[model samples]
Target: MAPVNEAARPALKAGTRDAHERRIDRAVALIERAIAQGEEPPELGRLAEAAAFSPFHFHRVYRAMTGETTGQTVARLRLLQGLRLLASERRSVTDAALAVGYQTPQAFTRALRQSLGTAPSELRAEPERLWREIDRLAQPPQPEQGEDAPPLRVEVVSIDPFQVVALRVEGGYEAKHAGYERLFGWAGAHGLLDRLQGLYGVAVDDRRDVAEPQCRFDCMLALGEGVDPTGLPGLRLTRLGGGRYARIRHVGAFDGLEAATDALLARWLPASGERLGDALLYHDYLDDPDQVPQALLRTDVYLPLQC
Candidate 1:
């Protein structure tokens, strides 16, 4: 066989990189979709098969590409989903525990505290503080800088009442795409796709305040006029009572939304003299993640304010 041409080596290497990234992305998406659909965590062999890698080498490959073991990924995803359920107040700790694949509530609590440094009860009571603590612990120490950061720009705007058909997802916010996939499928099947006026996320639990398992995010499709959700079996129809809101536009990855929200609730709200309203915080997804790059994704976070 002829030796590989030196000039073509970079192209070959780039092709290999692309193939590896595609495989990793496929594996990650499979894991996330299964979790979102409330399915048991896929076995390692199953994941390996899905990624078209040998079972023996898949674990190492996954870890090398993602910087975490497969078990670690499953555990993190499960724990985050469990926390979302817990925060929703709709499920008992025991229920949330089982729903997220824990054998019992005690086991879930132990893992929660060990991994997140907060108990389920503590998360319910002091969600914001505990969430902040988790975020702090997850990051490396930062250097103190002079106060020259740009101010968080917020606008007080009145929104009209609207209704949405939402699918409740009991997982970390990152798993929400699965819920959207289901919602879109349902709409497409019923020929209601054209009636989807906007895409919204109802944060049942403030992600910045709650543990991942205790957070509840609803993947919502804003309904156009005259659409009733009476026959939707698995979905909920929620009417958002339109009112004044403090809105902050977050630009960049979804991961940064938590910090933006913290800035809003901690700094902006107090300074703006706005009291929290009797409604949940929600998000308007301005750009579709599938179409936009992570750094360019836009989300408008809205905190309801009293009239």
Candidate 2:
């Protein structure tokens, strides 16, 4: 199945509803502005006024159109910027916490742990540890597979909760691949594995599903809390956008990922429109393939479709 073209959606009259589009545009712009300043966002009521939406209807419509509560989206944006600072800065954890707008270090730590699953200190100690792991995997061995392998037994479902570290990129196909490899190497060299839940390839652009002319992708790593970005070089962290997705748990290899993706978008999507909502086509690995291949592999491929 051909990938859905997000640009094409703009041409569809039903997708261009005046009220919904304004809400989404306002919400997105608000976030972009907040991230740039590295701070907490303003009240939803004020945002609603700016978007020309009544406060009572703004929250519901915003969530309906964007597939996220306004608070969740804003909180995530602030935290991603905060995590980057924490990982790359040399300042004390308390300083990093305050830099991102937390009233206190303890409050920041509590939020960090809930979101990323690690305390602040362990994340700070990953530099040396990551480097060692990268050195170990410098030369990866080939995998051997049986010719008659059964269709990799897998279950396709919907996933709405997951987080990832994503860097937006614009470039050639080869450059994208190389970028991800470098990111993987960086993650390993920094002992990021200990702090990360897993590694992921997150698509942040509307053009990704399109062909060569427009496709773009975000190379990402999924880390728990405490993975500071204070001292890391040339990296930015962005959370995976949360939403409804058609999910699949595939085993064996990542090579045939497209085929599974097709099944959801082409085969299942049309039938499941009633339960679907506005969301992106999302994909996330259940575990790291580097650590174990043919080792009970699990991956969730999320394709946002109308419910």
| Top TM-score prediction, candidate number | 1
Q: Against the unseen true structure, what C-alpha lDDT does each candidate score?
A: 0.70, 0.55
Against the true structure, what is each candidate's TM-score?
0.51, 0.39
Off by over 4 Å in 1: 1-148, 206-214, 230-232
Candidate 2 per-residue lDDT over residues 202-262, each given as its tens digit: 5443332345545566667777544555444557755554543445666656655555554
- Relative to the unseen true structure, what is the C-alpha lDDT of residue 206 in candidate 1, on a scale of 0 to 100? 48
Per-residue lDDT for 123 in model 2? 61
Off by over 4 Å in 2: 1-162, 169-177, 188-191, 204-214, 230-234, 241-243, 251-255, 273-275, 286-298, 305-307
As a whole number from 0 to 100, the lDDT of residue 197 in candidate 1 is: 80
How close to the true structure is residue 141 of candidate 1, measured as C-alpha lDDT? 28
Worst 10 residues of 1 by lDDT: 1-10
lDDT measured at residue 235 in model 2 versus the true structure, 0 to 100 = 72
Each prediction's RMSD to truth: 22.1, 22.0
How many clashing residue pairs appear in each of the predictions shown?
11, 30
